[model samples]
Target: MITELALRRPDDWHLHLRDGAMLQGVLPETARHFARAIIMPNLVPPVVTGADAAAYRGRILAALPAGMTFEPLMTLYLTEGTDPADLRAAAASGLVKAVKLYPAGATTNSHSGVRDFDKVRGVLDTMAEIGLPLCVHGEVTDPAVDIFDREAVFIDRVLDPIRRATPGLRVVMEHITTSQGADYVRSADRDLAATITTHHLIINRNHLLVGGIRPHYYCLPVAKREEHRLALRAAATSGDPRFFLGTDSAPHVDPLKECACGCAGCFTATNTMSLLAHVFEQENALDQLESFTSLNGPAYYRLPMNEARIRLVKGDAPVSFPDKIQTGAGPVTVFDPGFPVFWQVAQD
Candidate 1:
């Protein structure tokens, strides 16, 4: 068995570092392992304009622990009234890397999201023309559609139509949770790709519902059946450039997660690297780990791969990680893969 592995530092193509106290507490966890991350813009008010993105970026930078090197790749939340000119300026200024599309009521803090796709046509056209990628929460909010079937349905009803209409528009189907999503990205052209989260690779819907409701395992675009989890594992470990790591390590306080109305998100930033090492090893695709975690995301986003390196070592005993991360807000439960992880990132 391979005992030690080293690779170029990875970047998280999708991440949610919530504002204020939450941001300060969680930012370091991601920064410690990832050289950069595409910061999600779905805060309560949302980051809708270049100015909002810039201000958020400032806050992220300010919150970063001293001496830690990390880049927050800003994005704009696409709304019905999104200013195309402001997007152009954001792109030209090189401050914003992409625009995020959240169908209204699709996920947390998404009430301000776009309700009418037709209303955002001009914005989509401008994005295509300017080569700005559109990162999407690939699910529909229709009450008729079963929650488990939303992603597959969204592809057929929404994403396909949008792609067909707007040629050359780069799109990332974020946190894709089904074979439909994986196969679609594989069959699509270079302009399309998908982000497979760390937790999705290990957990299925059963992990969330079986025995009891595992709120920590619950996340938006919720984990699907076992077959879907297998598909994600294959895509991530197949050396397919269309798939990459995007640890959507969203953190919610324990009180919120354990309540009657729990929030949808999994806090995995603290142990993602360790989990990825175990998953890749089990797939016997350990050789392809770097491409999925480090190389592919940068290639897709048109950013350079990180120069720094990280080393993972397989130990004799199960690797130990914190069960929860304590913040001023409260205790945030860390995602437990429900399997022992024997690999850990080597300390400097």
Candidate 2:
């Protein structure tokens, strides 16, 4: 059995490091293990224009502790009012790596998202022409569509049609939660992929709804049935480049989470790598862990893979992780994988 494994440092293709104090508190959790991450732009006002992205990038760099090295790959939030020329300039300057599409009211801080897809045609067309990928929150906000079935419905009604309408447009279906999603990604021959979150691979709806409400396990594109969880595990550990890791490690303070109307997210930034090592080990696919966590994301985004390496060492005893990450915003809970994990990132 492999007890020590080293690979290229991973990158998070999707992450949420919210503004100010919250950003200061959680940035290090990811920086410790990851060399870079595609930072989510769903801030209160949202990171919309080239200038907005640049300013947000500056704040991220400013927040980085002096000794630690981490890069925040910025992205523009796509809106019905998005300016095509402004997006073009952002992409050309390399200040933005991708554009995010949130169907208005889809999830947290998405009120400024796109309600009319046609209104953003020029932006989409420019993105396709320039080869800037679109990172999507793959769920519809229709009141009629059941929450669990939204992803599947979005694929057939929204994503497929958008891809067809704009050929050469690359899309990353962020945090997919269904078998239909996995199968759809496999069926595509080009310019399409999906990101499987660490929590999604471990928990299903039963893990959320059964026994009682476990708020920390709750996330948008909320965990599905056991079969779907199994499907995600297979796709992630299958060594398929089209599927890769994007923790979607969104953080919401305790008060916001424990209230009558709770926010949707799981703060896994602090324990993602450890959890991933445990999951891959269970599948007997330790050989493929690096590919899922490190290689595939950069390949999809056309960025060079990191030269730095991280070693995962499995010890005789269970590794302990912090229960909550204290932030100026409040205490953010870390995701619990339910069982003990022996593997952890080696400091050496």
Candidate 3:
């Protein structure tokens, strides 16, 4: 077996590094693996403007361990009344990389998201004009819709019209779950891409319910049936430059996750690269691993690939699923998959 696969270093196209102590606690894991990560903007109030994004970036910088050269590519949270002027200013600053669209009630702390698609038409047009890509959460929030069907439904109701309404607009369907999502992104004319998460590529909806109500397996745009899981695996391992890595490594505390109203996220930031390598190996596509993990993402973003490198060595490596990770507020148990993972990350 190949001990290592070397290519351009990887960038996490989508990531959620939650703020404060949790940020500090988990930042190292992602930094250790990726050269740059497109940081999600879904904080309590959200990073709605250039200034907010800049300030949030500062906090991320401060929390980073000294001499670690990881970069956090910032993004703005698109709101109903979001100022297009601020979006332009943010893009002009060159710090803000993209704008995240979270339809109202779509996911965590997203109650403040856009209520109606029509409301953001002006904003979408402005984004296209300014050359800023709009990254969408891509799941509808309508309570009437079945949870599993939201993604396909959103593509028809929201994504399709949004693309038609604003030609030349760049859109990234973040953490796409269904084959419909893969098809939509693949069919778009240009500047349209989709990010497939490591968890989604490996596990199906059955994994969520098979053993039990696996809270750790639960994530927004939640895992679908095995057939969809198979499709995601094919796309990620197909060596297509359009499909790349975006470990939507969202983290929540044990209480929050285990509560009656558990938060929708999974804390996979720590073991993501290792988990990714495991999945790709299973697909027998180790040669194409670099494209999925590293090359494709930067190509889609029109950014330079990373010069730094990371190595994943295979063995009976161990990662403990701590009941709670230490945060400023007491302890927060991470959602572990409750089994021993086989891949181990090696020092650079």
Candidate 4:
């Protein structure tokens, strides 16, 4: 049996590092393993402009611990009032890596997202011309749609239509949860791709509702049925460059997660590498881990791969990770994969 594995250092294509205290506490968890990350633009006020992304990048750099090194690939949050000229300039500056699109009311801090697709046509056109990719939250906020059906419906209604209208515009269907999503991306041309999250690959809807309500297991575009989970596992391990790692490792305080009106997110940054090793091992696709976690993301974004490498070791005993991360805000629960994880990243 193989006891150790080493691969090129990975990049997180989608990650959420909220501002202030929360950011400080969780930044180290991801930075410890990932060489760089496409930092989400969904902060309270949101990173909506070139200036905003540049400033946010500075803050992320400042928050880095003394000895640790990590790069923040910034993004702009799209809104109805987004300016095409400004977006072009941001792309030209080469500081912003992509632009994020959140359908209005789709998830946390998304009230300012776009409601009318037509409103952003000019911006999308500009992005295509500049070779900038758009990372999208693939769900519609329409109340009548069943929560479980939102992702599939969005593909049929919102995503497909936009792609059809905007030629050459690259899109990433973020945190895709259904087989429909997987099939759509598989059928699309090279300009499209999808990101699979760690939790979505491990937990299904049943895990969230089996005996009682498990709030920490809950997340926006919540985990789908067992077959959908199986599909995601297949896609991630298929050695396909279009499918790569994007933990979407969002953090919410314990109270915010366990309360009546709990927020939607999962804190997986602390143990993502270990979890991915476990999953890939289970799939018998350990050889493909590097492409999924490290190589594919940079290739998709047209950036150079990291020169650094990370090593994972599997031991006879199950590895132990922190149950919760404590921040000034409160304790944020780490995602419980509900299975013993024996693989761990060897420390430097």
Candidate 5:
């Protein structure tokens, strides 16, 4: 059996590092393993302008601890009133890697998201012309649609239409949670891809609901049935270039996550590499691990691969990670994979 493996450093295609205390506390968790990450723009006011992205990037760099290196690939939040000229300039200067599309009320802090697609057609055109990809949170907020079926519905009703309308617009469907999502990506020919979350690859809805309400398991585009999980596993382990790692490692404090109106997010940044190793091993496709976590993301975004490499070692005993990490705000729980994880990243 393979005991140790090394590969090029990985990049997170999707990530959430909230500003202020939370940002300072959680930024290292991801930077520790990932060389860079496509930072989510869904903040309190949102990163909507070139200046906003530049300032946010500076703040991220400022928060990063010394003796550690990590690059923040910034993004702009799409809104009806977004300025095409500003977005074009941001992309030209490489200050923004992509534009995020969150359908209004789709997930946490998404009230400022776009409600009318027509309004952003001009911005989309500018992006296509300049070769900037759009990172999308793919779930329709229609109350009538079943929560579980929202992803599939969004593909047919929203995603498909937008793609067809803007032929050259590149889109990365973020944290796809269903077979429908995987199939949709497979069916597409060009300028399309999807990001699979580390947590989704391990836990299904049962893990979230079987015993009691596991608030930590709750996340946007909530975990689906076991079959969907299996499908995602197959796609991820298949070495499909179109599918890559985007650990939407959203973190909310214990108080915010355990209360009556608990938030929807899974804090997986801390143990993502370990969990990915566990899942890939279970699929008997450990060889594909590098492609999923490291290689594929940069290729899709047209960026160069990282020169640094990380090594993972599998041992007889299970790895132990902190149950919760204490930040200035409060304690934030780590994602529990339920089963033992024997594989962990070897310390440098």
Candidate 6:
């Protein structure tokens, strides 16, 4: 089936484009499909302040291939000592759209994340007052919590009370992977939403360890079981505006990923639309694809949808994992399903 529809151009509410060469190489792929992306602040040393976010935004803009009209929305990384006034200033300045809260050791470059929820209350209150969203990693750092239960545990112990305490605070549960997480977002009355990653909808934990520990599939808030995958698929294609697309296309070099200390991330920016189309097709929800992929995100962020359109043709088209995408450290071969994606991006 070949269909060309003028669906709203989407924005990635959460994305990671590493700094320097990797940023230059991988950014164009995202810009080509997404109108805007809330650039993650987990770079080395991390984007801890408004100045850092602004500078990082400048780098992303400079790295874009000259004529592409994509905007990189900036975020501040919430650390143990992140100042309340600075956060308010950043939100007021409109340079920082959201503040990312990463529980210490929860994910990549997140060692500097907030160690305790209470420690950052001042900053959180400030964000709530100023109307900036809190983009969360949404996983607990407790080693005893069982790897698969981190998201659920975090929700029970931290997120729920935080939501109650800070009424009207906007929150995004980034790359959610559990039924509990999904239900929580779905039930929220305030400004709460979730970003579903393409990988989580298509793969599970077994997919990561099936053929041996697959580093490429090893992302933080790691892919869950088959049941959760089904839940994610349902949420993404259910035409629910609370659920939208955010590739979370984090990239890590080969050595970094395939080592004893394998880095946690997935580089799916290149194949995001293809994978999303594949999921929607499986669900027989092609009609709703535009809303999940393109419309919901911009609406939640209060940004205008892109007027430009992208045409995707449905048919067998090979989407292979590159042996490596050259990064500063080395090459990185992302984990791919190793098959032809029936939908291919033809125009944008």
Stretches off by above 4 angstroms in model 5 are none
Clashing pairs in 2: none
lDDT of 3 at 274: 70
Q: Candidate 1 lDDT (Cα, whole model)?
A: 0.94
Cα lDDT tens digits, model 5, 95-211, are: 899999999999999999989999999999999899999999999999999999999999999999999999899999999999999999999999999999999999999998987
Runs off by more than 4 Å, candidate 1 = none
Let me know the TM-score candidate 6 reaches against the reference structure. Answer: 0.95
lDDT of 1 at 179: 95
TM-score of 3: 0.94
| Tens digits of per-residue lDDT for model 1, 1-348 | 898999999999999999999999899999998999999999989999999999999999999999899999999999999999999999999999999999999988999998889999999999999999999999999999999999999999999999999999999999999999999999986799999999999999998999999888889999899999999999999998999999999999999999899999999999999999999999999999999999999999998899999999999999888988888788888899998999998988
Candidate 3 Cα deviation (angstroms), residue 273: 1.1
Scanning candidate 3 in windows of ten residues, the lowest lDDT window is 329-338
How many Å off is the CA of 147 in candidate 5?
0.5
Q: How would you encode candidate 2's per-residue C-alpha lDDT over 1-348 as one tens digit per residue?
A: 899999999999999999999999999999999999999999989999999999999999999988999999999999988999999999999889999999999999999999999999889899999999999999999999999999999999999999999999999999999999999999999999999999998999998889989888889989999999999999999999999999999999988888888999999989899899999999999999999999999999999999999999999999999999998878999998899999999998
lDDT of 6 by residue, 1-348 (tens): 534444666678889998998898888878887889999999898999999998999999999898898898999999889989888888788898889998988888888998877888888888888778899999888889998999999999999899888887889999999888889988987599999998898889999988788888899888899999998888999998999998888888777787898988888887788778777887988889899888888888777777878887765446453556665556756548555676777763
Give candidate 5's TM-score: 0.99
- Weakest 10 consecutive residues of candidate 1 by summed lDDT: 323-332
Query: Under the 3 Å rule for N, CA and C atoms, how many clashes does model 5 have?
Result: 0
Clashes of each: 0, 0, 4, 0, 0, 0
lDDT of each: 0.94, 0.94, 0.84, 0.94, 0.95, 0.84
Model 3 lDDT on a 0 to 1 scale = 0.84
lDDT of 4 by residue, 73-141 (tens): 999999999999889888898989999999999999999999999999999999988889999999988
Output the lDDT of residue 42, model 2.
95
Q: Give TM-scores for every candidate, taking all chains together and pairing residue i with residue i.
A: 0.99, 0.99, 0.94, 0.99, 0.99, 0.95
Q: How many clashes in candidate 1? A: 0
